[model samples]
Target: MSRQASRRARSIALFLVVTMVASCGTLPRSGPNKREIFAGSVLQEGDAFVVSVNPRVTAATAVVPALGFSSVFRDAGELGADTIRPGDTLGLIIYENVEDGLLTSTGASASLIDEVQVDSSGFIFIPYAGRLRAADSTPEQLRRLITRRLDEQTPDPQVVVRRLAGDGATVSIVGGAGAQGVYPIERPTRTLSAMIAAAGGFSIAPEIALVTVTRGNRSETAYLSDLYKNPHMDIALRNGDRIFIEEDTRAFTVLGATGTQNRLEFETETLSAIEALAQVGGLNANVANPTGVFVFRNEPEEIARAVMGRDDLIGTQRLVYVLDLTRPNGMFDARDFVIRDGDTVYVTEAPIVGWNRSVAAIFGSLGQVTAAGSAVGIN
Candidate 1:
């Protein structure tokens, strides 16, 4: 080939290289590469805080959403099985020494009063005892009070008070439990865990089962497994308390150059960053940049302040944490780092990938150029 023609071909190749290099951003990619991400660092105009993963950062951001009962749940005392309350039914059997006593039938020394309902005011009345406070008193205590009131009208009165199944003290179990129903707060089921067991336990796996106890205006939640590990979570249940058991809905999104991009639910009570990667089959080995794994999250003000070592940031701050698995302690840092809900895990492509594609494109274009030059007999 002549020198001028060779120079023309060389210039074409150089132009192709420059064009390819300049258009790297237009290349098909899952997300931004490491350099592009670093370009948006906190020092830049973007408000997002970009931080490198390390032991200190991992420790500061290793928090999992707290799942357990609060002080209001733990401090409340348990209700007694026999404590009388409104809406409860009392079964009273009165015995008199003389036949045909005040409350007895003709020629009978005993009388049975079944289904004696306590009024909303917590008072119950007998033919001779009149109105007596029945709520807040145990069966034996109510029996004594009834006898004291009846003794003035009958001689040697004997009384027995039996608390029957009623709606006075009960809890409602709903959602992912083996059986969903309203259960009474009886002797065997006075606490939260016991009531759950009485409802045939949770339907989901214990590791992912979340139990929420709602009493009045407040509610608290804890993992079913946590209830077994921490006794304090097995709080005493109150009447009208509602218990809901459900699978953990926490999940993080995996995107970018990972093996697969999908939203994955938490597999355990606490999921680590490494574990979350493993769930999606780890990073794509071919194009993934081992030093460019990042977790994007909107951290609360308190955690954001602690992570960036700044006090001025407010509200939920966007944070992007970079992880370099090529470093000595990178694997450990990932293991210690916690993956929270609604987080996005991204793995950037290697820098060489873009260069490889550009080179391939240039060679293909060069073949086309040579074919046209030979057709015109330039060589």
Candidate 2:
């Protein structure tokens, strides 16, 4: 071997070694990463933006804070207990002694008046008794008034005032109910639940429904499922009140390396990140980067200000939250993170390993196809 040949061989070997090392894998470059939203500091200590809820999803039921509905209907109205209102019909009966002509035509006979409705003026008319105030008076109070007005015609008259159930307090229910239209409340103190039940409950599971109660000019809304947990939401219903139930319009989207990807309806009012992930078929273990799970949302101004300490928010705005499931505490932290409506949950792809497998599979398929074709040749 000559010196020239030895030198050339050494250079060629060195070049091959360098190429193999380069082809193995390149260093991760420093640049803007995927799913990066500027103005968000990396989730760390002292950052208020990443607010983590402390409760885990031990069960299917999740906690949802009432949105301006809790304080409004927490207590029942005192007026509807026994008070009568106009448009209500009363069944009346009169009793008097047979010997006392001043009081009697017959013994313990019912009033000829089948039923009397309180007029718009809040007055009911009797045969001997002139118009008497019925509205704002209890059945007992109206009974006393009716007997007292007939004192001149009868002696110690006994009277009964019964509310006509057919014409009593009623509520009109529409949407998401088993039965729709107006339903009469049998009693004055019928609750929200009773009225809904009277109208035939909800069409879908109450777990994912919202109830809107409108009483005259005032109206309020609450999650139907939460009513079971919070009784105050089941407030008493009044005459002419309107109740409606419908499936929740709020939902979040899931995409990227998750087992299932779609805009999923929340069967619950609210859910945390871990719970949301579970609901959407969880992370795709084969391709998901355990350290790159993220939730993108437009947080309300108050939350952004309180949690992120940012003042330049125009109502609700976008925010990016990153969760690293590679660490033991990552899932626990995600469990405590609340996912709001319109949120996007994304699990990014793991880079080098995933690409290597994909490339190998493509090459392996090509080699196998070529070998198979070579096996059969023209004779």
Candidate 3:
């Protein structure tokens, strides 16, 4: 062969070798070990009992009697307006006409005293009336007490008692909400949304927002999202009730060549596989083998038997779902695949691509060495 032709052939061979190496390097090895991946699998799909976004409360369903300043005084059967409870601060106003002689000057003299905090004993101290029973007594009732006391000394004494501070009949919100604090219910009626707002709203994602409400000794779980979607489920809050926001216990894991490899937490009630993938920044476009995405979940065998027998699963049952992303129709099926808490999604790399990349690197190094030798020879 001619010298120039021989050199050309050698260059072509080198190029082919480099190309093959690069292609080989790009391909992944044996995909991820199926057993290992399955062992670490944390993905599953099932109906999870979660708190309803708009939880329905049997107590809140019925119309709550209006309890206000005047309502307490009215003889109507409306729960006679809620009275001042323990840990309440109240204010009082006393108005005396100048002709009453109780005041040195005339002209409807009035005295205002604030911060009359109710003690644990349910009593508040009045300027001249001494300690009066306030806990469980309506503002009107308290006003009557003050008026009766002053009536003995003066003709027609008018008194007013109002709650100035201390959650003016509030519901305490605890647990997973944005702010865990007491929410005040000013009117006789307040809804779940109002209570949530008073507690600074929910901090966790709505998909996983679980809330529990405890009234008296009874506790019930509710989903805030569902409640929001269906207004009919929205329940009113009552006095002496405590609300708790709980952390989402359900979660799924995304592994392999995805953009982010971590356990993605979600509410078992609403997350689908497609949605979960989007949440984790989607699969790694360059490395993900569109045809080899798989999801492994623990499928409880004899679930019916277990339910009938009340048997607890000790990890005896499981299932694996392999999905192909390359097929156009597969996307639709994938979209409907719901993700359960503890489900594991694995995205494998295309084998040929890894092999190609490795081969490319080897040939690239050889080219560099060859070029260096040529430079040295020329010098």
Candidate 4:
């Protein structure tokens, strides 16, 4: 061959060899791979946040109280009964008797008045009387005030005031509860358990459920676990109070070549990839491929555009991080990778996965064809 032609051919051959080597997919031996690893540092048992609950106030303590009370009585004596504020409907019953010369005559009267709507001025209007301050008075207190006013107008006036409608009373139960609804606190008696029973009891698993109380804009979260651990956590329901049962918000699923394949739930706010793997009872000893672990995440494109400065291809923006588990240094990188909600982790087996499937298919086909030929020969 000519020298120039030989040189060109050699260069082409070298390029082809390099391309083939690259296509063969060699394992990373040195330097950090751009892919993120899913591993977390081992946290000791005491390392987690532990709030020491007093036994006196825990659910164990509250159990006696819960058992002592009936559902009916608990529903009746709740917080709404004790306080009467403005904007309450009052039912008035008045009895009057008049005596004539020979025979005595008596008359009974009952009336459902329009709501004694307490004005912003903190005054309520009665039928015969003008506006009276009733902003902080209970139903019984309001009754005495109305009676005094009537007595001033006449002698021995009989008056009874019963609160027909309480101040705007509603309790919101959310999260893990059997029913999530806004229940009206219509009467004086409404207990926490009663409210829960009214809306439906705790339906979620105790470990994963959380109850939050929000009054006005103030919010407080209570672990349902704590409710069992401490009785004091259960508070009386107040007007405009909200009860929220939060679902198991922290959880991840591990699948493929794992000892156990199932969705794992966590109570902690954050979980690393390694922690998620551990929760799934660790990887399968025989089938797990140490070098081919992958975490598939549906990342929003906006995040990539901001952080990685990558091209925002509308549909293709989602990223898949393929991690190598064989390297010891990869463990630290995996620790840094935080598990997000609905994240799926797939630990793949070796390339023999495809070969095994192919072999199984070939055997099955051979058996079927052999059977068909025998039937044809018989025919």
Candidate 5:
């Protein structure tokens, strides 16, 4: 080939390489590289507070939303099944020593009152005893009061009061329980766990099952397994309490150069950063940068103070935690780092990947240039 043709071809190839290198930033990439991420950090006058993963950082951000019962639930003592309420039915039997007494008939010394319904005012009426307050009194207490009232006319009157199951204290169990119904607060099912067992345990896996109890104006939620582990969570249930058992809906999003890019549900009650990565099939071996793995989250003021070692922050702070698995303790820090709900785990592409893509573009353009020069009889 002539010198002029060779020089022209060399110039064309050099220009193609320069163009490709200049436009390398526009190459298709999963996300920003490590340098780009650091460039847009708070240290670089950016809004996001970029932190490197360490033991202290892991511990500071290890806070998870806890579930438990308050004093209203834990301190509220169990209700007695025998305590007469406004809606209870009392079975009464009146016996007199004389054959033809006030309450008894001829030859019959006992008179049976099959059903005595207590009114909404908590009063029950007998034939000769008149209206009497039956609520707030036990069966034995009601028996003594009735005997005293009937003893005025009948000789040696004996009164027997039995409390039968009626519209008394009850709780409604629903959502993810083996059986959903309203169960009375009996002696065996007065507490929270006992009532759950009465309705037939949780229908979902205990690991992800959540039980929420709503009493009056307040409600609290706790993991089903936590009730067994923490004694205080198994509180005493109250009347009109509503229980709902459901699966945990907390999840995190995975993106960039990982094995998969999707939203994943928490597999356990508490999830770690490493386990979250594994759930998405881990980092992509071909293109992932081991030093550029990042978890993006919005931390509250308290957590932001602990993590940034500063307290001047206000409102929710945007945070980006960089995890360098190449470090000796990086894997350990990741194992201890808590992956909270709504977190975004992103893996940047390797540095070499961009250069490789640029090089491939330049060479492919050079090959076409070389073939065109040969067709024009320049080579």
Candidate 6:
């Protein structure tokens, strides 16, 4: 090889040797090893199940359940509009045979009633029917009451009642909508999704939304996207129901040698390890140790016990989950791993990289020495 090419070959050889030596550096001192948390094969069937944050760990197969808030929707059912109340407007039409009625002066033999607001006493005054009770009465029931009373004075009476300018039930919506206000609940079974759509939908994708529903003294919350995935979560809306859509405020912290180290919000409630990494701009390829991608969480005692193979474990233990992207199966594990709120994703720096830098520094020193020798030899 030429002189310059020969020096380049030697530098390459030194870099490789230093990298190998650094790879075998001493292990960090720590407490006794817990159960072999280092996993390789897929968790088989009948293995001790240790999972949380959307839970998919299983021995044979991973089965994840829908959000717990789905049950709140189930219990809500539908709101009814069968009963009338005060502040309701009613339209009435009365027709009577003037020839048979002494009270009629043959005016028009018909009466056109504009609109009558129901009084707080649950009564509306009709010309011939006198004061009729309309509150808490369905349209059919009120029509019959007017017909029965009119018949007593006139030979033949016809009466019609129509609801004018009032709604039976309504719900209130607030936050991130084109129009945030109270909206009518017209359908017998108005779902949470329907209400949101009617109110002009959300500014962002529903999957990235956190929705809260308040009814009476109880308030429940769920991800807007989860409601779409599991239909059961699209709960029935009731009268006086208040719904609010919050931003995708859930975030996790990223540390160590990732591309970007900071707290990042989730685009959606459900995320895998790979997605979390992508959120933080993935690992720092040049500096990160792919084998040391760890997701740290303070697991509930039950889950820690199961995964740690310790029945005696309490619910407050912290856990470190390792994912080696350097291995073929590492990506698969990452894909299946779920990330929860407040988790910390850390990527370690590759040790071999440090040693490689040292090799470069040594070569740099040699070049300076050789350049000085060349000047002296020339003199």
Using TM-score, give the best candidate's number.
5
Q: Tell me the whole-model lDDT of each prediction, alpha carbons only.
A: 0.88, 0.68, 0.63, 0.57, 0.88, 0.69
**Cα-based RMSD of the predictions, in order?**
2.4, 7.6, 11.3, 14.2, 2.1, 8.5
Q: Output the TM-score of candidate 1.
A: 0.91
- Per-residue lDDT tens digits for candidate 6, residues 1-379, read 3677656755665565556546866333221121233332125332233232222342212222233464655777565464555667788777777654533446566676867988877789987678988987887899888888888888778777887754545788898775799987765338888888888888877667778898888887877886778788888887678998878776788887777778888776677889989887888778787877777677677666666666886557666677777676778778778777888887776767655656665566556555654565521
Candidate 3 positional error at 74, Å: 28
Off by over 4 Å in 3: 1-169, 175-179, 202-207, 216-218, 246-249, 267-269, 302-316, 354-379
* Model 5: how far residue 96 lies from native, Å: 1.8
Candidate 3 at residue 379, lDDT? 17
Q: For model 5, give the 10-residue run with minimal summed lDDT.
A: 20-29
Better of 2 and 3 by lDDT: 2
Flag clash pairs in model 2.
48-307, 53-336, 103-154
Cα error of candidate 5 at position 220, Å:
1.2
| lDDT of each residue in 1-379, candidate 4, tens digit only | 4666655654554455446545766532221222222222012222111111122212211111011222322233245364665555566665433332111133324334534566655687765656788756777887788878766554555667676666456677777788787777754336565677777788877766666776666666656666556555545677677777766566677777777778877745456667777787777776567666666555555543433344643442334445556676566555556667767777765555544644555455545544554465421
Query: TM-scores across all candidates?
Result: 0.91, 0.72, 0.51, 0.49, 0.93, 0.69
**What does the lDDT read for residue 169 in candidate 3?**
62
- Give, for candidate 1, the lowest lDDT window spanning 10 residues: 20-29
Pairs that collide, model 1: none
**lDDT (Cα) of model 4:** 0.57
Residue-wise C-alpha lDDT for candidate 2, range 120-143, written one tens digit per residue: 878988878888889889889998
lDDT of 6 at 79: 52
What is the Cα-based lDDT of residue 256 in candidate 2? 73
